[model samples]
Target: MTIKSHSSRESRNPRDFNDPRNKPQERSERPERPERSEWASRRSDRPEGATRERTERSRPDWAVRTEQRRSPRERFEGGDRPRPPRGAGLLAELRELDRDLIKMIARRSRMLTRLPASGASDHERELRTSWEEHASAVSRDPKLIRQIFALLQEVEVAPADMEQPTAFNLAPMRKPVNVDLPAPASDRLPRVHMTLAASGASECVLHGVPLNNPVMECLKGLNQVGARLRWEEDGRILCQGGEPVSGYSKSILDKVVHVGDDPFNLFLILFQMVTRPARLKIIGESGLKFVDLAPLRHFLPLLGARLTSVVPGQEGLPARLESSAMLPSEVAVPADLPADAVEALLIAAAGWERPVTMALGEHPEGRSVASKMLPILRDAGIEATLTDAEGALSLHVVPGKAHFGVEPGTGINLSAAAALLALPALAGGSVKLRGAWDATGDDQTREGVRELFAAVGLDMRFSADCAAVSFGEGLGEDAELPPLKPLTDLSGLPSSLFPVGLVLALIPAVRAKGGDLPRLPQNTDMTLVESFLNQLGLSCEDGRLVSIAPASTPWASPSFPWALALSLAAFLRPNIKLVNPGIVTNHLPWYWNAYNSLPTPSLARKSAEEEAAPAPSRPARRRVLASHTPESEMPDEIVYPDED
Candidate 1:
């Protein structure tokens, strides 16, 4: 190196071509890169297993996974799809179809209107039949289709001319009547029936029998079932029992009997059928036709019988009952059944005359009904034992050796009468109810009736004879009655009085705080009751009556009791229009006359004022009873409440 020691640049200039540091080391120094396939094939430059890791590191995790590239339209369309139809065009077509269907219905209605009435009825019946058949063939509910077609028929056929309709009006009453009511016939009906059915070849004469529609219907039923019934001289009922009358239908008329709309009659008749192996096709009209007898299904099996609704897809009459005549010695009634149903069961058990045991689950109202009916059975000479054991109520019934006669007060219906009287009593008026007071019962107990009225903030007085009830008279004038106290316990109340108490209690409950009414022991369907009250001008909400107003439209009452209640309610709140006033005649033939007989409140007040006005010169005279003479007399200037 020392011998050639010239300048280093001069030394390496010729040798620079062969020097390693003088040449570019990168692959880019070559003119161009090889194809990808060729670069992959030349893997010798990488370590033996480092190629994968190096490639993964070089590209991101997302880029490492291979995927097919797609265009924006393809990505959003989710592959090829058919084009959507135009919404506007489809809606237009639907509207046109609806218009065509309506036009067809109108044309059919006009054609029906052109036909004669008889022809139209026949044609409509045929159409209904066809509709039912078609619905069945298509595996649809026939009843539902029948209802739909029936509605159409009713809408199109009635009142052919819409512009000039026929005028149908309800005869209006000028005033309400204040009439004396006898005790309930219900107390005596069972005894009468028992005497006819249980006695062997005995003739009994029944006098002063109420000839109300329900009573007559029951008599007719008893007669058809083999009891010889005839009207006797001096207005008495003569019933001759031939053989046992209760077990089966003895005559052709008994096979299909109409019980009208009276539940008492229906239950009594049905239970009579339950005692023997028999078949009955029971039917009813009006309100009875709509009663749901589904609850009876649970109790019938215990008596070896079956009750089935004849109407398809409905739980009401007309119904058919089949019995095997084999009854269980002991039966258990669940707590949830209605009160009337339980009473019907008891009636059947009493008729059977065998030692029968009934276990009533924790139903207080049902127990009360059983308790009341047991006395009736005992009066009919049946030995009945009601006991409370370990919180369960049970009744043991057996036939007794002694027979009892009907009591005097049995002629009156105190439940209905008391309910009716509540209307006038609440309105500050007097009602003279000339009913035979039960000497043995507590209903006529002056102290009890006084307490009942006192609970509602009304001062009531019952005469020592218990013939007349006077309370709240002249209260409507100048006197501000205390707010009606809410009645929380209605279990012990008379049947008719329950509704009155319910309305009074509900008024305050709704206006103050919205909530459900107190739980009823009867387990009544309060929804329906509330709805009915609202229709009758008691505006109900949240299961309570919020306000009282005039009913805007005419409403048809389901039963006579309901009609009576509604009429009384209307008297309280004016301008309510009720349709079908004649329906009440089914139960109370003299209902309209008696209903219109009550003097108007104004007239009552005027008469009361006249009575209160003392003679100008003479002092007011007081009749003193020697047994209860008072130390002081009421002042003439201070008017006393009206009394009979």
Candidate 2:
């Protein structure tokens, strides 16, 4: 210990000491510390082999200590060192391509939900403009070019937007296409006219033209029996009542001619004619229903038209009219023709029996005729049989045991005939009707028939369950009666009651025998009844159910033409009643002027004036015309001229 001590710095490792070669080193003489291994051995009591080795193993090594020397990013995050950076250009390019692809996908998704221009709503058009602007912006961006190409694979380019390519130098499309042939005219084809007689009084005309359509084939198999037809200058057929034309007339003449545009009307007219024609044939290509004609085979004979059967292969059958020596006058006209037809015949037959009584019944569901009347012959005891011929229902009234009850299958034709039978009894004759009969039901037609009788001054009475008529005397100048009242309820009565009630009512009223009775309008239907109330200034809130105040006057005379009156007489006969002359004449003076005047247009003029006035001013704004030109003010090649 007395020996001179060496400096502690000289005992330290050279790596731990300062370098004297590079710079001036400062040294201090101090006592040296013990070695770390000696200190560790002195501090621990455990065995050196196991405990010390375990402690050394638990401590971090040089590799972990070197890991603490992190690069810039790792040092900031307090983590291990990082590798050196790669090039930036490639990574930025790749990132930009991804962004472009995402934007393209978004645009395509928008385009998918958009409708085309033609079907676009207001909002859709605005969206389309915005989308186009966005697409143009994206196209100009260099960074989005790759994404645009990739998205093009997913989206379809509208054909309207694509440019049409040509192999060589091509010319622009010409305005009009060259066509060598002329356009066809509508009226060039030949035409034919077919006339069908209805009810032996009127005729329905059909025009046919040769369109050569499939429906024209129906003209085959018609009989050309007793028809006198001549073509007019205007391509119409004047079919007069005469002898039948031959079926073998000519192929061109035999084939029916087609009509103008409306083929359905022509078919209907032909159907009506063929069903009851004296003779019929296809003169040309007239459209007809072959299937509908089959069911009418039985009616041809009654119509005086004879239908001939065709051979299996033949296309059409010839039709002939049955000839009889009897003249039109000699042939008793049927009673069941449409009211107009019956009236015409009656007028012609001025010498007809004055008061012909008839019996009527309800019309069956599927019956073609509106109504029927069975005549009651005085001398003969045979009941009447009625059948529809043409538009008329022929009444074969032979005096016999009275048959006045309605059978289940009875149709309107029978009811009409029965009504005719009851007419004479109302006119001033004695008649008896058997069984109950009533016409009241849901049928508007029945109400019409009832109205016809009421208008002529019939003493008609109806109950909820029954209808009755009492012919005390007859309708004449001498007789007088009380006013008429509306009848209610006539259900559960026999169909025959309609005719019997009419007869009983008509006899007394027409004879002027005295009684109160219901009044009706000339038109003779539920509609007419309602119209009459409306004309009298009453309103109807509900359709079938009507409310009416008691009429000031007893009755009103119906305003109708003589022809209508005659039709009523023929169909309704003597059972028809007339209103008092005083009530009708009185109202005519006051109401006629209103009916004749035309409606004024003051209100309409006011509305037009209001619409023509200028609109109110608001804020001024820029007026935007539709895009028709480019930035140079010249029309763009893709710009639509008319869009502006």
Candidate 3:
């Protein structure tokens, strides 16, 4: 349809497509851009040919910008600053209060320095009471306040102060004689006698109960509440049950019972309060001062007992317990109550006038205190049954006439055993531990003691009489012993024994510089242990032992196990001094005596050196001349003899 377009296009251009000289016509219809607005144009004060940037540089706005600059202070004043934090005011107030507390403590220290040294005991008692009351009023820990005051007492007010605090030392016992430790009496004996008396049982005789300070305190407290307990010359405790007096008529001092830091003693007192109508003031010492008895406070009300803290804000002893005559027959025990607490409850239930059924929520394991205690309760004539119904365990205790039929078999005190076991390895001598078996048929603690020795490649021999701990065969020398086997499993050991176990465990970990350690129990408060370890140049975190150049510093602690461990460290480094060695009295009253009796490591080394020394020379004897002359006379013919 467009056949003529080629010729028409060729004629219009009039040149070949490839021609170099071809030219195209320009179009005249394109429109020009409009003039820029005033904002885009340069300032009028500059020359016409000047660039826009040069014109702006000479403008008067620069002077105005310079004049408008403000200081940071002016900006803040004008509300250009950031907002303050939420609790800034409260944090400041708290800081002020802390400062005031420190100042008051310093002032008290100065005043104490100025006071005369006479009547120091009275002053100390008054100060302790005042500090404890202040701590309670201010919602603080009494233990922490007491520690602060103890430290202040240690501070030397003036160089002339002659009556410094006593710091017991173990150096005097460095070269002691042979140590034969006395057989440890059973710890369960005290609990047994106390529980039986609280249960309204008839008078019974208990043999082998050591009349230690803690035991004596318990006996005295029981006597105050009308329980007839007397220690005979033959080491038998005769406990006669009596009705405890109730109400506030008794003097506060008579009602006040000092437990001396044992939770078991406290539990027995709590049991006595619920078993009979009694008004008692319970006081604790040492670490038990911080024990929170909230669970008991909540549970005791069901048994018609009112437990209240003597200090308003605190929750533990010193506390007051008041009970009514009405006793509940059916009581549901809290599931999470401590196993020891449950045992105390079961013991106390035996004295109830009516049979009380306790709905214990869960069945305890074999190692639980309740499990071991159930059999003892049964043997004591109490009908105690532990049954499970739909996963909930209940204890139905039927009250009966209970008596101590046979001598409760003697057993080793756990605390003493733990400390004594370490002596053989540290002091290079054998230690005989008696009463290792429990008459109640629970040897869990005894087994734990065995494991503690076994971990360090030591041998513990058990006979009918006692258990003896000594070096394993062929491992008498320290260097000959094998590598310490890591004791990772700690289920066999009770938490109370952990302090000794932990120190023993660290021996290998630190000596080796890196190794596995026993994992810390989830429930243990390792504040003291961690602090002690830090002082020794070691760090423990999540069961990992990181050695940091251990130092041989003097060890001082109120904790018996900690002090015991440090004293044992002298075997590792002989220079490590033990300060406050008398703290061992808290557990083993005769520990220092027993420990002092042991041969010192240095003395043993000195003896070894003497054994290695050369013996004195003996004078040489001259031979007789007559025997030599007879041989010379026969020599001429004898010299002629020849070999064939």
Which tens-of-lDDT digit does each residue in 481-538 have in candidate 1?
Answer: 3456666665555545555555544544444544445445475656657655665455
Model 3 clash tally, residue pairs: 1
Kindly list the per-residue Cα lDDT of model 3 for residues 291-387, writing each as its tens digit. Answer: 7688888888878888897655455667888877468888877765666677777777777778888776643441355566677778777788877
lDDT of 3 at 333: 75
CA lDDT, every model vs. true structure: 0.59, 0.33, 0.64
Return the top candidate by lDDT.
3
- Indicate the residue-level lDDT of 210 in model 3: 66
Q: Judging by lDDT, tell me the better candidate of 1 and 2.
A: 1
- How many residue pairs clash in all the candidates, one count each? 9, 85, 1
Top model by TM-score, which number?
3
Q: Which lDDT value does model 2 have at 642?
A: 83
Q: lDDT (0-100) at residue 512 of candidate 1?
A: 50
Cα error of candidate 2 at position 393, Å = 16
Best first by TM-score, ranked? 3, 1, 2
Q: TM-score of the candidate numbered 3?
A: 0.64
